[model samples]
Target: MKGEHILPLSQSGSARNTHIEDHLDGSSAAIKVIVFGGLDGILTMFAVVSGCAGAAISPLQTICVTLGTLLASAFSMAYGEFISCKAERDYVESERLREEREVEEKPEMEKKEMLDIYTNRYKFSSADAHDLVELTFRNKDFFLRHMMAEELGILLTEDDMTPVKKGLVMFGSFCILGSFPLIGFIGNFLGESGSDTSRIIGFTTTALFSVIGAMSLGYFKGSYMRQRRMISALMMALNGVVVGFISYLSGLVLMTLFPEASI
Candidate 1:
């Protein structure tokens, strides 16, 4: 799964924060929703606004297009996440059942597999590996679960990867963080009508805001992923830049095709 993200089973944090999460039941999945949804919201709206401004599209049209895109994207993200998560859980369960059956029907084969894995993959001594496998196989359920977790990278608990929860978080966070770009437009409409600011100025300001949004996501990423703050921030900002430039080029190409539209 190229470009796909995998959540870790464990994350380190301050003792106080760990205790807080223990009580609150926080999931690393939430970090995915917040970081991705937040970044998408800010970046997409900013790009659309910048593109509309570049094309000299009317303010009213800009509002319509931006809002349309945001609303559609929000829905898509939420529903898509829900479906994907559900599918993932189903697939994992299906595989778990298959593994369970295999372990039950072919205990010796599985023991050998476990022994080989421990010895070859993990470099455990042959005697130790055999003993470990024997101990593990004492409980059928535990043996199956351990095999899946260790060999297949399955999350045994899956306490946090709820589809509905992830979907709602994605949609809600996207809406909340996505509104930043629109805030500027809203301010304009509330005051003296949105004046025709220079395209360069508008794009510059919008890009800066988008970069800030990206950095915010990156901060969350660093906190959750236990990575360096500056690197994550710069990487996110770089992604935003790529999106913005692509959008800008698209606008230019459209303007070139329909020269009269820019009129």
Candidate 2:
């Protein structure tokens, strides 16, 4: 009797499952920027609000300060991402063009260099290295790809997400996510009289939300659970202090300048 054939379990799944898994594994650059950038904004704003509340400032003033900070931070983050990506792309392209020109002008030298690189990596004999180098040089694209990968540490064919798109996604996510804690503060303040109890409740609520946001970001970024959680907490706390200081100072100034104005 003929031996029975068997298929591997891993190979038996539907192609759709494979496709879905591959897609999921592909990291979205936009999502990454949003997650990190949003965390930064939320942490900063939360710190500001906490500080203002600690100083016994009005909820309205705290809200104003948080909003201003959020807008400024988001814009700055977006612009920075754009410029950085643009610079990277420009550098990579310039290097690639220069390499291509070198290949045309000094084919034999470039071939020898490629041989040396591969020989050093694989510990191949000089004759075998020469043969491999000749084979690679016969295909310009493949030779260039190898050079780029080894020398420059860049993929020749992978599509980079547009910097503008990344910037917009980051800014939008930051504005929306960072606004949650502030919204909680506003809601609490508007619902109750401006008393110490109301202020405490508002601040506590804001912190709680900030913690949740940070934890979520950490998990999404594949960070170590304990470290990420603590880092997130500290960042948010620091933000609270900065924002609070600014709001308190503004309130003090306004109070001094117009004593009649209820700050």
TM-score, every prediction: 0.81, 0.74
Q: Pick the lDDT winner.
A: 1
* Model 1 alpha-carbon drift over 4 Å, by segment: 1-25, 123-125, 193-195, 198-205
Identify the leading candidate in terms of TM-score. 1
Over the stretch 62-86, how does candidate 2's per-residue lDDT look in tens digits?
A: 8888889899988998899888777
Superposed Cα deviation of residue 97, candidate 2 (Å):
0.9
In the range 13-51, model 1's lDDT, one tens digit per residue, is 332385655643456567767888888888888888877
Worst 10 residues of 2 by lDDT: 1-10
Q: How close is candidate 2 to the true structure, as a TM-score?
A: 0.74
Candidate 1 similarity to native, TM-score: 0.81
Error of 1 at 217 (Å): 2.2
